[model samples]
Target: MNLYPFQKISFLLVITSTICLLYIPRSLGAEDDEQYLNCSASFQCANIPNIGYPFWGSSRPNYCGFPEFKLNCTGEAPVISFQDKDYRVLDINQSASTLRIARTDYWNNVCPVSPGNTTIEVNHVEYASDVQELLLFYDCPPLNIPLPIQLTSQFNCSINSTANYINYFVTQNLTNSGLTNISSTFGTCNTTVTALVSQSASENLAMNSTKDNLVAVLDSGFGLKWDASNNLCKQCNGTGGQCGYNTSTAEFTCYCKDGPNPSNCAGKKKEIAIGLAVGGAILFGIFIGFYIYSFIQRKKKKLAALAQSKEIPTPLTSKSVATPSTNLSQSQSIPSYPSFTSKSDYDKGSTYFGVQVFSYTELEEATENFNPAKELGDGGFGTVYYGKLQDGRVVAVKRLYENNFKRVEQFMNEVEILTRLEHRNLVKLYGCTSRRSRELLLVYEYIPNGTVADHLHGKRVESGFLSWPVRLSIAIETADALAFLHRNDVIHRDVKTNNILIDNDFCVKVADFGLSRLFPNDVTHVSTAPQGTPGYVDPEYYQCYQLTDKSDVYSFGVVLIELISSLQAVDTNRHRHDINLANMAINKIQNHLVNELVDPLLEFETNHVVRGMATAVAELAFRCLQQERDMRPTMDEVLDGLRAIQNEDLGSEDGQAVVLDIRADDVGLLRNMPPPLSPDSAGTDKLVSSSTPPSSF
Candidate 1:
């Protein structure tokens, strides 16, 4: 084991050289990391400071972070696009992995006046746990709820001046309690939307009850956390390597002292090895160029053939017609439909509603040339034909008669109203075709199940009787639809069983808005000739020329009574005293003879819960049928009452009589109701010219 002095010295020198060679890369890598991290210069946007990885923009390149997380500095604010929606970035905290964003449309107040469809679609970012949602209700009808609920940001909508300034109330709780209970607890409003608000902003809303405070809180926006995993960046920074991404491979790359590599600090020797490999690859690529070119040409041919196979045939027209981008333009040349004479005229009709204009040929093909076999129903103004479009969409095509000017007016009115209206419980108007035919045609979403009238007392009665629960749901849904309409300053004007269609699931879809009147936001009542079904018309409206939402409430009351008694609104077979359903229902309810009017199919006597719900409904119907317009309850109140009855029914079935404790101040139930008219008033019923006939379509 003895060694010469020269041999030991040589061994120690060899050991020292090996250790120095290994330590060189680590010390050099640390230096490289500092330079790489500087690639993403600390960016300052507005009040936000020190933004770097996971968010690249301004002076930073895409390789520094995710490309989708790019921010655009517009004016003094930094804007980011998430799922195609632009949001203003308020603050960024890299340590917390969170960012504050406010919807650009909301901040600018460029969104629709209604908040029903206002929703945020966050991509790769989630709302923070402390986020609070504020619900804004616009153009809501006057509700008789408690003062505190009513006082929540009651201000007129800038767009809808006719409306009693829109009411909005913010809530942290969204569970369904009862219709009136919830509407009263939360202001009676339509179109609910949730927005994320800061804890301080929410506290401000609670402490300060001013509209300015609400606007300030909403403008301040909410917080969102990102899934930014910075492990690679940290590792690269620690190793003295610059963190970046390989564009072609979309993989993280570390820029070291020597060159770029997939891992931290691959030193000078590896860089030289990579350079030699690159030179060899370049020479090999030159040799294979011709073969690669041939392969790409063949691939291109295959792609062209595939595209040709998938191409749809374009329609042929005389004189090389230019394709129209919109439905109105497609029908503009058709001289038969004079109503759509110009682009401006068509725009006036279809622009506000955003309804499509189907080509005449498309409708003709969809409806099989209006074949009689496809006919769904016939009405006074038009005939509805079932049709399946080329797109596999089933629709109801109503081909109007347009026999008179009045009929044409109705057709135009329906087109204008239905296009603007959107609700789950309301039938959707797909589009309209007004060319290549003598009559105007309207397309609506086809509901496979028949109308409430058919299911209850009309042709489809033999199919099966509706259960109490189904009937109750229809009532609540219909009420909700009406309330939504009223909130938007629209009156259905024809709320009847026939107008209430059902889907395959027995869900209500309120249809037929031909007679609907758009009450201006500033006007409480529109002065028009009274027009509605005879038995359902508000008596006050029948006697006077003025029309209000209460008129529809009267009609809905008749529909409610029909749900209970399963009788036609104007059934003659009933005793002469009970001919008009509204009048008869009111009389029976006042006399405490509601049980006698219950539908026999309901089997009310066998179920105590059913009996109580039926009685409660009858009372609600009575309130709706109040002779004076002022005495009638708002549709919001009606929906709440129906929900209360449903909840109570469900509760009773569970062996608990859950009395919905709706505060008296919330409900404001009418008392000391006027007595029903004597038999003489019924005998003296007179038809007036000012009264428009019932909806036949």
Candidate 2:
């Protein structure tokens, strides 16, 4: 084969051009991957019992998701894209309310190499980094490439900076304008369009109180809806929007209202009208101009006076503007919360717990610039810093990596979502502040005992898991909280050992509500994607996108199982079946091997009182894990059953210890117990857990 040098060189040139032209956009595309959520079946959203559009889990059902992005819960943790290349399950974020993931590296084939203009159909969630919560993107450079940030429709971030070592980061202070659509040249987006409906502040969803960070989009939509009452926005309902106030302590927005359009511009139309009316009148032109000018000046003065008189009362030397029923400022008089019914009273600091405001500078000093040392922990939303205010109270301050206006709405919900809330086992939200960029901070009575996971794993003051009485108390309290939520038509989705914090005496307090939803009768179970921790999650939730109070029962059941075994959710080294704590416990107990599955630390009292509580809890856990969601008991029924067990008092002469003076038929799901976990999305897997034990609670 003899070929001329020029001929060979020409062919090589063609190959080089082809490679560059093909790889450039795909490479740049990686830099802008702001894919905030790519859930598989394994990713746990304790709040969400099912998966839906823009989210793919049961990948086995079809090639769902971008191939290989299939997810499933492993009784330990949820696994994503299990057998595919770069198949890694990242994190379930409660804060910011987005699903974060680590993606596998692959080549994008722009088929029709010899021609052009190919078509790709998308059936799953397609997130264009240029149009979503920007902080969620990862390091997939050619590092630090200048990229455009896009959020929904009509909102775009034009950040054209050189990427350093990190991937494209979400610019803080980004606000949401109800997005509609975005367009790119040649369907590729050399430019994108973002639609901002009104001038509302950034809406930050409380990702998930205590679960992740209270900052995720709970429900976002733009269907056939509109609320033209207060005249706030058009084309959107005030349904999902939350109202929040700042340091001024006053503004109350129940939701958006109907207001006039650009024609409603302050002074524009009236001024023109007066000018016309006078000019046409009997030579009243000069008088009308002078009179109108004076009127305008007076109106401006009144507006200023109103602004000055409108102020939220303040504390002696702090930044808080106390809630004063009589002295609300004009600005405070404006309602910023969504139009949901008054769920509770957020105005009274005495009822619920809330946070105090600190100048950004003061917060900086308290946290030593949010130093890693003052850091208590890092969560899905951002980081938590422990600090002591000058008043001598030790507090935990959460600084969000991104801005969240939606979280403010939750504060409104805390104050007004439902009505009537009274429960000792639940954590109280005193107040909150979405000012100075931290965006969301909740002040609660800090509990010193750590989480239930700590005690159960044997990692706290007791130096071992709880005694039988303590375990009984914890179970009862947690159940009581669950019952309360159910009563209010709300579901505490992420109920687990970690979300259950203990105090010095081991009293349990249920925390976190980012995933809590108003389970109104009209709305069956919510159909968002599945969310929760790994090992302890429910299977029915993953199989169907319907979240009910029953789902919470399933997750709480996992926590009960964890309390019994004193084991972590997952241990990579054990047999797949044994790796699941719930499965392991059921198998051992069913085969009369209760001794093998029970935590030896609680050698306290296998007596009736202790055994009775354990037995009741185990039975309840078993029902919650029913293969059918309907088969699960409601939290109220669970509580009543526990109360009955408590009333029995396990056969004590004093009478608080008899094993239910009642019969089996009296119990519903608890009646004829089903076989333990059987192991599948829809089938119960017999229980078990791996070898390594996590810390004690």
Backbone clashes for every candidate come to: 11, 130
lDDT score of residue 424 within candidate 2: 74
State the TM-score for model 1.
0.44
Stretches of candidate 1 off by over 4 Å are 1-353, 403-416, 434-438, 649-697
Off by over 4 Å in 2: 1-365, 401-422, 434-438, 461-465, 604-609, 649-697
lDDT of 2: 0.45
Every candidate's CA RMSD: 25.5, 26.8
Error of 2 at 201 (Å): 40
Best by lDDT, which number? 1
What is the per-residue lDDT of model 1 for residues 552-639, given as tens digits with 9 covering 90 to 100? 8888999999999988898668675566787678778888888889997787888777788888898899889887789999999999
Q: Give the TM-scores of the predictions, in the order they appear.
A: 0.44, 0.47
What tens digits encode model 2's per-residue C-alpha lDDT throughout 151-178?
2211112223234312222222332221
Best by TM-score: 2
